[model samples]
Target: MRSLEIHGIDDLRVVDRDDPAPGPGEVQIAVEWGGICGSDLAYWRRGVSGTAVMSHPFVLGHEVSGRVSALGAGVSGPGVGSPVTVHPARTTGPLPERLRGRENLHPDLTYLGSAAGDPHTDGAFAQTITVRADQVVPLPAGLDTRRAVLAEPLGVAMHAVTRAGDLTGAHVLVSGCGPVGLLVVLAARDAGAARISAVDLSSPARERALALGADEALESAADMSEEITVAFEASGAPASLDGILRHIARASVVVQVGNLPPTPISVTLGPIVSQELEYRGTYRFASEIEDATRLLARTPRAEQVITHVLDLEDAHAAFTTAATDPASSKVVLRLS
Candidate 1:
C-alpha cells in the first residue's frame, strides 16, 4: 500500500506501507478521493494548525470517500463494494453518562490526520485504510465520487447552520468564502435563509459563493451597510470577527466556525452588551454527515467548489497548490 505522510514544514512524501486489515467492527476501504482541507494546508506549510503542532510524521487527510473492499467480523450491511464516506472523529472509549449523546465533546476524541494528539492517528489519504464500520456513511444512490468527497466539509457547514438555529427567512452573512464558508452559503440557503451574503478577499471564491446562491458577495465585510441578522465567521481572522461585530444587526447571532489562532486577541464587547448580540462556538459535527451526503446529491452546483484534483503520488504539489492558490477552492487527491 502507498501512504502520504508529512515529515516537516513544506515536506511531504509518498511511501510504502503494509496494507491494513479490518478488525472486528471495522471495514477496509479502497480510497477513491481525499480533499485537501485548510487545516491540512496549515500542517504542510508550517507543521501546525492553530496550536496543534506535529511532533512526529503525520498522514494528512480526512475528507475522503471510497468503496468498501472488505468487511471485518462484526460488520454487516454497507457490504463489500458499497460506496461510502467516513466520519473522521473516533472516541477512544465510551463517553460518560452525561455526555453520551454528545460524542464530539468527549475528552479522548481522536480525529484522523489531526496533530492534536501525540503519536498522531493516521488519516485516510492512502490506497487502502481501515476504519470502524459505524463511521462509514453510505453514499446516496447515483452520487458521484467527486461530489461525495465533499461530505465531510459540507457536514461542518451543516453543523454551523444547525448552531445558528431558526434561520427561516433571516438575512445571513458568511464571512470567508473559502470551501467551508462557501458551503455555509449553500447550507444557509437550504436552511431557508431569506438572503445570503458572502465575504472574502478572493474574487473567485466570492463568485463561486454567488453561484451557489448567495444574494451578495463582497471583497470585505467593511463594505456592508445593511445590518445582517446572523453571521458565520469562517475566516478565522481577527479582522473578520471585528467586522461581523461592527456590522451585524442588534441581537443578531454569530457563529464562529473557523479555527482561529491560539493566541489571545482583543475584541470589542460593546456589541455583546449594548446590542445584546450572541456569539457561539461550534466544533466538529455529530450527525450531519448524512445530511451532507443528501444535500450534495440534490445540489449539483456544489461540485463547482472542487477546483483541482491530483494523483496521490503528487501529494507535495497538491498541498502546495492548495496553500498558495487563491483560485483553488477544494483540491482533491485521487487515490484509486
Candidate 2:
C-alpha cells in the first residue's frame, strides 16, 4: 500500500508500506479520500502540532473516508465493502468524575494522526489502514466517501456550537472563516441563529462563509454592528481575538474553538469583565460525530465547502494548496 508519511519538517513523502491487517476488535479499511486539515499542515511544516511532537514517521490524516475491507475476529456487523467514515478517537484511561459525560475532555485519549504521546496513534493516510471497529462508522445512506470525509471536522464545528449553548433566534458572530469557522456558520444557522455574521482577513474565506450560511461576511468588524449576542472565536489568530471582544454585545457567549498556540497574547480583557460576558473553551469533539454524519447525509450543499481534491501521488501538492490557497476551503487527497 502507498502511504503519505512525514519524516520531518518540510519532509513529507509518498512511501510504499506493507498493508496492515485488522487485529482482534479492529477493522481494516481501504481508504478512498482524506481531508487535509490545518494540523496536518502543521506536522508537515513544523514537525509538531502544539505539544504533539513527531517522534517517528507516521501517516498524516484523520478526516478520512473508506470502505471496510476486512473485519477483526470479534466484529461482524457492517460487512466488508461497506462505505464508512471513522470517529478517529478512543479513550485510553480511567474516567474521572470531572470528565464523566464529556469524553473528549478525557486527559488520556488518542486520535489518529496525532503525535501527542509516545508510540503515537497512526492515522488513515494510506491506501489501507487498520483501526478499532468501534471507530468505524458506516456511512448514512446517500453519503459518499468524497463528502463524508468532512464528518470529522464537521463534528468539531458541531461540538463548538454545542459549547455556545442554545442559539434559538440569537444573533451570532464567528471570527475567522476557515473550514471549521465556516462550518460553525452552517451549524449556527441550523441551530436557529437569527442572523449569522463572519469576519476574516481573507476575502475568499469570507465568500465561502457567506456561501455556507453567514448572512454577511466582512473583511473585518469595522462595519459590523455591536449587536452580536453569541460569538465563536475560530481564527486562532491573536488579532482576531481583539476584534471579537470589541464588537460582541454585552453579556454574550464567546466560545474559543480554534486551537491557539501555547504562547500568550495581549487581548482586551476589559470587555469580558465590564460587559459581564461568558467565555468558554472547547476542544476537539465528543459524541457529535453521529449527528455530523446524519447532517452531512441530509444536506448536499455542505459539499460545496470542499474546493479541491488532489490525487494521493500529489500529497505534497495537496498540502501546499490547502495551506497557501485562500480561495480553497476543504482540500482532500484521493487515495484510492
Q: What TM-score do all the candidates reach, one by one?
A: 0.97, 0.97
Candidate 2 lDDT (Cα, whole model)?
0.88
**lDDT accuracy of residue 246 in candidate 2:** 78
Q: What are the per-residue Cα lDDT tens digits for candidate 1 across 114-134?
A: 999888988888889999988
Clashing residue pairs for model 1: none
> Can you write out model 2's per-residue Cα lDDT over 146-247, one digit (the tens) per residue?
989999999999999999999998889899888899888888888889999999988888888888878998888656677788888998987787778877
**Model 1, position 77: C-alpha lDDT score:** 69
TM-score of 1: 0.97
Off by over 4 Å in 1: 97-100, 225-227
